[model samples]
Target: MGTDISRPEHPPLARRHAWSLAAYRHMLRKRLTGQPAADLKSIADKRWDIAPGEITVSPPAIYLPGQMERVTGWEGQRFYPYVHPGPTMAGGLSIEQGPTRGYLIKNVWLIDGALYKGNASHWLTLKPQRFAPVLVENEIERGAIYCTQNGNSWFGTWLMEDCVTYALACDEGVPVTSAPSARYPLFTQAPPYEDWLGMNPLRLRTAFFHQLVLFDDVSHNRSRHQRYRAMGDKLLTHVEHAPHPGVFILRGHEGDLRLLRNELEVAEHMCVKWGFRVINPLRLDVPTIIAACAGARVVMGVEGSQLVHGVNVLQPGGTVFTLQPPNRFISYYKYMTDRDGQHFAFVVGTPDGDGFTIDINEVERTMDLLPKH
Candidate 1:
């Protein structure tokens, strides 16, 4: 792995008090490309027949008729009972991208409101320029909401990318709004041997946290837990023992077991440093893992899906730090935090330096600027 400076710190201000137009210009560039933004005025202004009592709704492309029947048992059902369809596992029942299209409203419906967990109107729309269009008639019959539960394995990139793309598209629309819920399922469930490489479609859903703190590479290296706990002891407040906190450690199919060994070592070390307990759930469920992160003040790990989990769990203005390969994929942190309206930073470890050394000064500096929740 090689390292290059992708996004570097801005030059120091000679006069901190004086306003710099250059700084504003730099900030503008970062905002436009980094965070979710779309050009969708046509869809935002259109008035759809939002029928009275319609509680849930979504596009038809991402949902499959078979899956709907299985979940809702509404065989040959015509009318939708809710405004927003609840989470579904069907791959096709989702909103599509086009020149700001029309809206579709169906009959009102009811759902287990408890399942509708997370911030309201928190979603990110994406445009899959490469994949074939999945929508049909731009309308879908609303039914029970189905959330996708598979993202960590073969379909991980596809689903995550789709979610990210959706968020960006929505941002482009006039009077932009965030999606209400983002669904992250396990990757192991993905159909075997699905190609992960290629221009996969991106998607975005509403996030649980106002800000996402991503920690990567928890298990890939050595003594990770000790290093993280030492770091957390300095940054977090009210560290508590979670007997069974659902924590998800993302791993690739190849070389993943080795990575897990490394991450486990780190977790063990962290426990020793801060007396912080490690809670490993037998099953890696996304919702449960997210709930645990939601309760956390600081999230630290190697750069991986756990970081993505942190993204979903962090409160607005929360801070995240992940390990960076000496050179490759350095800008990922910036790409995530800047575009998503969250505080992002990275720590690069030298081969000869301490196994873990975070730029505490930088962490403090970033934390100071975070919005008070």
Candidate 2:
């Protein structure tokens, strides 16, 4: 249930130049027709005035594509296309929406990072693009950071994997700035990004960092989850009388193939009668959500990004029952949970007209089918 994740390698200078030329032609063509061309600069690698060691990389314009049948097979189920192509013009200017064509960014300062949202694009698209050596904005004045609003729903992207980027930048001895942007509040509830990495926020982002590092998605690494779980445990110490340890039934609120048409009502009734805590994650913050799921042995929900929180909190060897919506059976979560040693299972509901509905008996069967701990 896994597909190869192709990592972008730095191409030869000649080939890079060719790519640049091709990109320029493409942009020119789009421009003649009055299309947005924001990614034209991102096609070629550019060098700054900083020394080689001071600014260590010339990265390509990273383009992570939307879900494909060739990769996930679930693309056939989606009602709309994964990512829309062409120039993304908002207010007569090109906007960066990676995975789609014409999205390119170069000379991105590490200090004040940008946020790309929706589904798994934040980590899959934006984060990996930051895998270069450059001056971070955190080492400069309070207002020096450049911020941009790109997409919708940052969701859970500001977790451990995001913090590790700064940690890696600091290790590389890269000059970082100390500027704080207003966008920081929207990114995380915490004051300093460095605290998550177990470092002093001021010292880490303000000084030279000598190390560089990279990471895949969160569930691919257990130690990362362990670190997150420890952080969750520490946070839970402050909550007086948190929910008792048990199974959790995650009720999803948003989606085309959502748990609707009395399916959720039936599911909720059964879940409550069966000793499960029904949680609508949309109402909770990241820590509180993690704290709730960390204590549970089984987590069940309709498959979506919010279910990602389940993998984050559910312990190793936990059970995740994903409710698939007819043809839209994507395996992103299954791939993750399986890698993390969690028992992953799913039940495709009966297609009820355009959407679908799950019989509570299916839930009962899934519950019984779970491996006993």
Candidate 3:
């Protein structure tokens, strides 16, 4: 939601600054309005930065008591807390705590999945708003903290200072987009920093690397499924035997899994008819999944995370038929194609009398427009 502020008709420099400040304050006010009173105060205080070598001994020293509740809610499900014991100093420094009270905070971040395990790409793509702050008090007091209980984990932290600062810089801006992409990968081997200490660290320093494919709009979820099926059928019609190239269908649990399964079945039937191979890479690790899609000529899937993978692995000029959701929230796909110069088709679907159906003709029409690989 957008915030509104009054501005002078002919603004002077001071007046413009005043307006900007007002808008910024208004945004923060809106953000904190619904927060618990104590949480709000802590957020106000710790929201600022702390420099290196600062040590926080007490819980309040790091996290304001009430701020924890404000940062997390029902969806997070659990909160995990960890301390960076000074000896090895292995754990990432906590941004929540510091020596100075009013300094602007920087560099504190979160990631999902095992702290140092592979297969953690999901943690890389998440935006900053998704990160909740770690509540050390709860962890110390309760013994075990659950994210759903109102707290943040290492996985939910955002390390990208620029994104965090930009988000916070925009008074009252949504912080989700500003979160560091979950694509950052941590090193498995102990690096120079850990090595210099002569300590056998559990994991190496984390590195921010990896391209992200975010899909925003799903206006044609149902229809895209139909079009995917129809395209499989048409491709089948042309081939006397199964085509040399295979088809991979990817989907997630969110949307109509039944319809997705049906579409997969159609693709299989068409494959049988034309002799093309059909592959269902069900919840495979990111690398293997991408590798599989990279080799395929066509990749089809419902608009979800798997579609993101399709964008990553599908051969350039390779066809991607993305089914969109009924309601469009954000348009990550447009950004992907436009920014990266990727070859793809976006099919906006219409609701059918029965349920939802892709415009087969439109699907063909769009397919015809695809640049040949």
Give the number of the best model, judged by lDDT. Answer: 2
* lDDT of each residue in 1-373, candidate 3, tens digit only: 1111112121221211111122223235547775422221122213332222223222111111222222211111121113221211112233322221121211111222111112111222323222333211100000000011111112112111111222122222111222122444332221321232222211111211111111111122322223323322333332233213535454534333313324555455536653434445454543344344445555555544445434443333455555443333123333233223344444444444333344445445555555554
**Residues 1-373, model 1: lDDT tens digits:** 1111111121221221111122233335546767532322222322332111111222111111232222222111211111222232211333221121223212211111111111111112222112221211111121112122122222423233323223222222211112222232334522221121111121122111111211111111112222322322322233333332223243322322213224455455545543323444225553344445544444555555445544443443454545433322223333333323345444343332323333334334433443444
Per-model TM-score versus the true fold: 0.33, 0.50, 0.36
**What is the Cα-based lDDT of residue 57 in candidate 2?**
17
Assess the local accuracy of residue 100 in candidate 2 as a C-alpha lDDT between 0 and 100: 11
lDDT of each: 0.29, 0.39, 0.30
lDDT, candidate 2, 88-158, per-residue tens: 10112222211211122222222223211111111212222222223322212111111112111233334
Q: Which whole-number lDDT from 0 to 100 does residue 320 have in model 1?
A: 53
Rank ordering of all candidates by lDDT, starting from the highest: 2, 3, 1
Best of the two (2, 3) by TM-score: 2
Stretches off by above 4 angstroms in model 1 are: 1-160, 164-186, 189-262, 272-283, 351-373
